[model samples]
Target chain A: MSLEIRNLHARIAANGTEILRGLDLTVEAGKVHAIMGPNGSGKSTLSKVLGGHPDYEVTEGEVLLDGVNILGMEPDVRSRAGLFLAFQYPMEIPGVSNANFLRAALQARLPEGEELEATDYYARLYEKMDMLEMDRKFTARSVNDGFSGGEKKRNEILQMLMLEPRYAILDETDSGLDIDALKIVSHGVNAMRGPERGFLVITHYQRLLDYIVPDVVHVLVGGRIEHTGGKELALELEAKGYDWIKDDIAQAVSA
Target chain B: MNATIEAPIETVSEENDSLMTTGPDFASHPEAFRARQRAAWEKFVSLPMPARTDETWRFADVKSLSIAPYTRAEVVDDGDRAALLKKSIGIVETSGRMVFANDCLLARDIYNDTLRAKGVLWLPMEQAIAEQAELIEKHFMRESGVLGSAKFAALHESQVKAGTFLYVPRGVEIALPVETFHWLSGEGASVFPHTLIIAEENAKVTLVDYFQSAGDDAGFACGVNDIVVGNGARVTYVAVQDWNRKTLAFHLNNTTVARDASALALRLNLGGSRVRDEAVSRLRGPGGRSDMLSVSAAEDDQIFDQRTLQIHEAPNTSSDLLYKNSLNDKARTIFTGLIRVDEGAHKTDAYQKVRNLLLSDEAEANSAPGLEIEADDVRCTHGATSGQVDMEEIFYLQSRGIPLRLAHQLVTFGFLNEVIERLPGEPLQQKLRELLHGKLG
Candidate 1:
C-alpha cells in the first residue's frame, strides 16, 4: 500500500499563480521518506494541496491512497479516510477546550447514533498526553491558544497519535523548536512509526534529519524531485547546499 | 389583596376600556400608596406612546406598541397554579423567595424572626406598604427611569399588583441571595412585576428576579426595578428574562450608588419575541462604583433592544458597562449606550463595551456607543465590535475531523462564556450556564 501522487499540478486559488508543476512522488507504507527543499520550493504547497485546503486548487493530479482516489474529498472526509496533515501553524481556537475539541474529533469518527465512551476516550488521551509531556491543565485550555511553538508541534503529534491515520505528513515540524523540545517531538514521532503506516516528513533544515533518519532522501526543486538517494544523500546535501542540486538539474535539462 | 385608585373619571374610563386586571379588589391597597398609583395613572394617560423618532426608541418597532389585545391576568385554576409553582423552581438555596403567577401569590419563603429582629424587612409589596410604610414611602418609585421607557414605567406603576420589597438596615449583611419569580399564564394575559431594594450604610446583599411565561401563549410584560445603595454598602441585582417566544416585554431599571458604595447588575435574555430593556446606573457619591453587564443569546426571529446609561456625578467615581450578544437564525439585537461624566467630576473612570457574535448570515446586530466627558483628568473608552466565527479556527477543528455545525457551536459558546464568567457568585453563573446551554441546544 502506498500514497502515490501522479503528475500533480496545482496553483493558488485566489491569484491563479502556479506553485506545484508536474510533481510526482510515491511514499510506501512502512518507510519514512524525507523531502528536502529550500524556501519557495513549493514543499509546503504539496502538503496543503493534498489536504484539500480551500486556498489551493489541484488542476491536474491523482492522489491514490491505497489505490482509492481521494482528490475530491473534503478535508474532514479525507481525515476520516486515514490521511492526516500535521499543520505547520496550528490555529488557536479560543473558548474551545483542548479536551473537548479532541473529543468531538474522535466522536465524529464513530458510527451513526453511537456515542463515544468518555472514560475510554480520556484514558487514551491522557496516555498520549503523557507521552508528549503535556500538563493535565492543558486539557482544559483552549486549543492552541497561547501555546508555545514547540508545544504546538508536540500537540500536533499528540493529535496524530490519537487519530491513528494510515498516512501522515509532518510539515516543518522541527522549525521554532529548541534542542530539548526537538528531541521530545522527534521521539514522539518515532514512536508512531510502524509497518502499517507511512510518513512523509518535509523540512528545510538537516538538523531534524539527524534524529529521525529518513529511509529515502528526495531533493525537491521547482516543485519536482530532482534527485533521489538513500539516507547518505542527506549528508551530501548538508555538506553541499540546495544550490548544487539546482545547478545539476539545470545542466541535465539543458543537455 | 385589595387596592384603591382615585384617579380622575376620564383616566379610569380609559383604563376600563384598555386595562384587564383592575378588579375592584385591586383598589384595596393602603390610601397613601393608592394616591401615588392614581397620580401615576393620570401621568400614564397623559403621555403618548413613544415614537421611533425618539432617540431612546431608535431601531425599536413602534408598530408593536398596541395595548388593546391584552387585559389584566386572572388567577389560574388550582391544577395550573400547582404546575406554575413547580415551574417556578429557582436556585435551590436562597435567603428568601417569593413566587407569583398571574398577579397572585402562589408561594413565599422568608428568613426566621431573627432576621426581622435584626431590622431586615423582606415582605410582599402589599404587606410592606402597611408595615414598612415609612421606608416604602421614602424609596418607592423614586425616579422615572430616563431610558425611553417612561410610558411603560407609568403603566407598571398604575397596574402593578405583583412585586417584592427588601430593606436591609445599617451594618446588616445578608450573605445569600433573595429571589423573586414572576410567571404569567393563559393566553392574552398581562403582568406588571416590580422589585424595590434599599440597602442602609455598610450593608451587603444580592437579589435576583426571574420573569418567565407558563405556556406557549401570547402575553405582555411590563416590569421595573429600583435599587438604592447607602454609604459603604454593596448591592447586586441579576435579572433573568425568559418569557415564552410569543411574549412582548419591557423592563426598566434605576440604580444609585452612594459614597464608597458599589453596585453590580447583570441581565440575561434567552426568550421572548421582542424585548426592550433599559438600565441607568448613577454614581452619585465619591468613591462609588457601578458594574453593569448583560448577555443575550437570540435565535429564530427574536429581537432584543438594549439601552443603558452610566452617569458619573461625583469625582473619583467609576462605572463600567459590558454587553455581549450572540445572534443566530435571523435573530436581531440592538445596543445603544452612553457614558456621561459631569463637569467637575474629575478622576472619573468609565468604560462601555459591546461585543456581538454573529453565527448566521441573516442575523443582524446594531451598536451605538457614545461618551460625553465634561470633566478634566478623566479616562473613558468606548468600543463596539461585530464578528463572525473565525474560519481558520473552524478549519483547525475540521482538520481534526469535527463537523462544521458542531465547530460553529463550540466557538459561539466560547464567545459567550467569557461574559458569563464575569458573574460574581458560582451558583448564579452555573444556573445561567445551564440556561444558555438549554436554549442553544
Candidate 2:
C-alpha cells in the first residue's frame, strides 16, 4: 500500500491564492521521503491539504491512502484511515491531560464497546515519554499547555509514536527543535522506520536531513517536485542554496 | 436555648397549607425557634421582589422569580417513597447517608457506629431539634444571606422542616464524607431542605448535598445550608443540584470561618429552569481561609444566576472564589461577585474570578466582578471573562480523529474540570463529573 497524490490542486481559503498546482507524489511503505522547499513553496499547504484541513480547499485532484480515495473523507476520518500530520505548530489544549488526550485518540480507533486497559496504556505511555526524553509528570499536565518549543515538538513525536499511523507526515518538526532535541526526535522517528510504516518529512533546513537521512529527497519549487535526488542532494542544496534551483527553473521556463 | 423556647409564636389560620406552618412539631422545645420563624415569614413578605434595575439582579429574569403557585408538598405514598430512597444513592463509600423527600425524612443509614460514639450527631433536623436542642439552636441559620437572596433565605427559614444536622466534635476526623439527598417529587411541590454543620475545634469533616427530582415534575426548592468552622477546623462542602428542567430553585449558603479554620464549598448546577444561588463566606478570625467554587452546565432555555460575597473581617485572612459556566443553546448565565476587605483587615488576600464559555451564538453570559478594599495592606483582585471555546483547541482535538460532537463535549468537560479538579475530595469530584457527563449525554 502507498499514499498517492494525483495531479493535486489546492488553494488558501482566505484569498483564494493557489498554493499547490498539479502536484503528484507517492510514498510506499518502508521508505522515508523528505520534501525540502523554501518559504512560500507550499510545503505546509501540501501537508495540511493531505490531512484534510478545512481552511485549504482542494480545487481538483485526488488523495488516496492504500488505494482508497481519501479526499472525500473528513479530517478526522482521514486521520482514522492511518494518516497522521505532525503540525508545525501544535495547538495547546488547556485542561486536557496528555495521558487522557492520548487515551481518547487511541480509544476512538477501537471498535465500539471495546475498552483499552489502563495498565497497558500507562506502560506504553511511559515508554514513549522516556524515549522522547519527556518528563513523566507530563502525563498529568495539560496537553502542550505551558510547554516550551522543544517540549511541544517532543510531544508531537510522542503522539506519532503512540498512534503508529501507516503514513506519517512530519511538517517542519525540526524548525523549533534544538540540536539535543533534534537528535532525540530523530531517534524516535528512526526507531519507527521499518517495513510496516512510511514517512514524509517536510523541512526548510538541511540540518535535519543529517540526523534522519531520507531514502529520497524531493525539492518542491512551485507546488510540484522540481527535482528528485539522493541524500547527497540535501548537502549540495544546503551548500549552494535554493537560488540555484530557482534560477534553473526560471531559465527552463524562459527557454 | 431557653430563649428560643420562650419566644411567642404566631397563629396562622391557612387551612390549605400542608406544611407545619404554625411551627415545627419540635419548636416546643425551643420557643425562640418558633418566634424566629414568625419574624422570618414577616420579613419574607415585607421584602420586595428583585427589580430589573438592581445591580445584583441585572440581566436576571426578574419576572420569573415569583413563588406564588408553589405549595408545600405532603408525604407521598409508601411505595413511591421507598423507590425514591433507593434512588438516593450518592457516593459509594460514605460514613453516613440521610434521605429526605417533600421536607420529611424518608430514611437514614449511619454506618459508622464509632462516629456515633465519638459524639458526632448525624440526624434529621427535627430529631436534632429535640435531642441536640442546644447545638441546633445555636448554629442553625446563624449567618445572614448577604449576597442578595435575603427574601428567599427568610422563606427557607420559615418553611424549613426536614434536612441534615451534622456536628463533628473537637479533634474528630471523619474518614469518609457524609451524603445527604433531598428529593423533590409531585407537581408544584415545595421543599425546604436545611443543612447546618458545625465542626468544633480542629475537627475535619465533609458533607455533600444532592438536590434532585424524582421525575420530570415541576417543583420549587428553597435550600439553606449554614457551615461553621471552629478554631483550626477544616470543612469541605459540596452541593450538587439536579432538579427537573421545569423546576425553579433557590440555594443560599453561608460559611463562617473561625481562627485558623479553612472552609471550601462547591456548587454544581446541572438542571433547572431558573436557579439562583447566593453564597457568602465570612472570614471572621485571624488565619481563616475560604475557597468558594462553582461549575455549571446550562443548555436549552435554562438560566443560572449566581451571586457571591467574600468578607475579610480579620487580618491574615484569605478567600478565593472561582465560578465557571458552559452555556449552550439559548441558555443564559449571570455572575455577580464582590470581595470586600474590612478597614482593619490588613494583609488579606482575596481573589474573585468568573469564566464563561459560550457554546452557542444565541447563548448569553453576563458577569460583574467588583472589589471593595478598605484595608491599608491587602491583595485583592476580581475579574470576569466571557469567551467561546478556543478554535485552536477544537482543531487540536479534531485533528486527533475525535468527532466534532465528542470533541466539543471533551473540551467543555475540560473547561469545567479546571474547577472540579481543584476540589479537595476525589469521590465527590468523580460523582459530579459522572453526573455532568450524564447530563451532556
Candidate 3:
C-alpha cells in the first residue's frame, strides 16, 4: 500500500493563479521520499493542498491513502483518515497549553463516548516529550506561543510522534533550525520511522537529508517533477544548485 | 413563610412589599443605619431608570433593566440550603468562607485560627454592623458609584441585608484568601448582596466573592462592593459572577488605594441574561498601584455591559486595566473605560486595554476607551480591539484532528486566559480555569 497523488492541478482560490500543475508522486508505506525544489516550485502549496487548506482549490486531482481517496474530505477529516501535515510555520495558539492541545487532538481520534484515560495519556505524552528532550514545562506552556524557532519545530515533531499518522508530510521542517536543533528534530522524526508508516520530506536544501536520509529524491521544478534519483541526487543538487536541472528541463522542453 | 421577615412593617410600601425582601435584622439595626436605609429607599424611588439617551447607558439594552417583576429573596428551604452549601466548594484552601443563600447565611467556616487571633475580623454584614457599626459605616459604599447604575446602587443600599464584612488590622497579614458565596434561589426573586473590605496600613490579604445562582431561574441581583486599601498594604480581590442565564444582574465596585498600597481586582462574567458591571479605582496616594482585570465568556443572547474608570489622584501612582471578552451565538458585549489623570498628579502612569473575540458572525462587540489628562508628563494609553478567531489558528488545530467546534472553544479559552494568568496564586488560577472550562464547554 502507498500514499499516491495523481495528475493533481490546483490554483489559489483568491487569485486563481495555479500553483500545482499536474503533480504526480507516490510514497510507499515502507519508504521515505524527499522532494527537493527551488523557490516557488509548489513545495509548501502541495502540503497545504494535501491538508485540504481552504485557500487552495483542487481543480482536478485525487489523493489516495491506502487506496481511499481523501481529496473530498475536510482538513480534520483528512487527518482522522491518517494524513498529517507538519506545517512549515506552526501556528501559535495563545493560552492553550501544549498538553491540553495534544490531548484534545488525540481525544478527537477516539470513538464517541470513549473517554481518553488521563493517566495513560499523560504517561505517553511525557515519554514522547522526553524522547524529544523537551523540558517538562513545555507541556504546561501555551502551544507554540513565544516558542523559539527551533522549539516550535520540535513541538511539531512532538505532535507527529503522538498522533502517529499513516502518511506524514514534513513541509520544510528544516528551515530556521540550527545545527544542534536540526539533529534533535531529526532524531524525533527518525524515531517514528517504521514499516507501517510513510514519510514525504519536503525541503529546499539537502542539509536535512544528511540526518534523515531519504530512500528516493525527486527534483521538483516549475510545479512539476523533472528528475528522480537515489539519495545521491540531493548531494549533487546541493553542490550544483538548481540551475543545472532548470537548464536540462529547458532544453528538454525545446527538443 | 413571609419572605420579607426582616423588612420593617411601617416603611414597607405596598409596591415595595411585592418587590423586596428587606433583611430580617433591619428592625433591630441602629437608628442611624435604619434612617440611611429609609433615605436610600426614597432616593431609589426618585431616581429615574437609566434611559438610552443617557451617556452612561449608551449601547446598553435599557429595556431589559426592569426589576419591577422581581421581589427580594426569600429564605431558602433546608434541602435547598444543603444543596447550595455542597455546591459552595470553591478554592480548596481559603482562610475563611461564608455561604449565603437568598440573603441568608448558611455556613460560616474560618479554617485558620491564627488569623482569627491576629485581630482579623470577618463577619456577616448584619453582625458586623451590630459589633462594629462605626467601622462598617466609615467605608460602606463611600463612593456614589455614578457609573450608570446609581438607581440600582440605591436599590441595593435600600434592601441589602447580608454580606461579608472583612477588616484586616495593621501589621496583620492573612496568608490565605477569604471567600464568600452569594447564591440566589427562586423564580422572580431578587437579592441585594454587599461586600466591604478594609485593609489597614501595612496589612496584606486576598478575598474572593462568588455570585452564583442555585438554579437557572429568572431573577434580579443588585450587588455592591467597596474596598479600602491603607498605606503599604497589598490586597487582591476577585469576583466570579456566574448567575444563571435568565438572571438580570448588576455588580458595582469602588476601590481606593493609599500610598505604597497595591490592589488587584478581577471579575469573571460567565452567565446572565443581562449584566451591567461598573468598576472604579482611585489612587489617592503616591506610589500606589491598581490592576483591574475582567474576563467574560458571554454566549447565546447574554449581554455584558462593563464600564470602568481609573482616577489618578496622586502623583507617581499607576493603574492598569485589561478586559477581555469572547462572544458566541448572538451574544453582545459593550466596554467603555476612561483613565483620568487629575491636575498636579504628575508622573502618573495608566493603561487601559479591552479585547473582544467574536466567535460567531452574529455576535457583536462595542468598545469605547478614553483618556482625560490634566497633568503634564503623565503617561496614558488606551485601546480597544475586536477580532475573530484566526482562521490559520483554526486550521492548525484541525490539521491535528481536532473538530471545528472544539477547536473554536480551545482558542477562546486561550484568548481569555491571558487575563486570568495575570492573577497571583496557582490554586486560585486553577480553580478559575476549571470554572471557565465548564462554561466554555
Best by DockQ: 3
What's the CA RMSD for each of the models? 3.3, 3.6, 1.9
Error of 3 at B312 (Å): 0.4
Candidate 3 local lDDT, B198-299, one digit each (tens) = 999999999999999999888999999999999999999999999999999999999999999999999999988999999999999999999999999999
RMSD of 3: 1.9
- Candidate 1 positional error at A80, Å: 3.0
Question: How does residue B148 of candidate 2 score in lDDT?
Answer: 73
Report the lDDT tens digits of candidate 2 across residue range B235-333.
Answer: 999999999998999999889999999999999999899999999999999999999999999999999999899999999999999999999999999
Chain B only: TM-score of model 3: 0.96
Top candidate when judged by TM-score against the true structure: 3
* DockQ for the candidates, in order: 0.59, 0.66, 0.87
Score candidate 2 by DockQ: 0.66
List per-prediction Cα lDDT, in the order shown. 0.86, 0.87, 0.91
Docking class of 2: medium
For residues A139-250, what per-residue lDDT tens digits would candidate 1 score against the true structure?
A: 8777888999988998999999899999999999999899999988898889989999999999998899998988999888888888898989988888898999999888
Q: Which is the better candidate, 1 or 3, if ranked by lDDT?
A: 3
Residue B364 of model 3 has an lDDT of: 95
Interface RMSD score of each model = 1.3, 1.2, 0.6
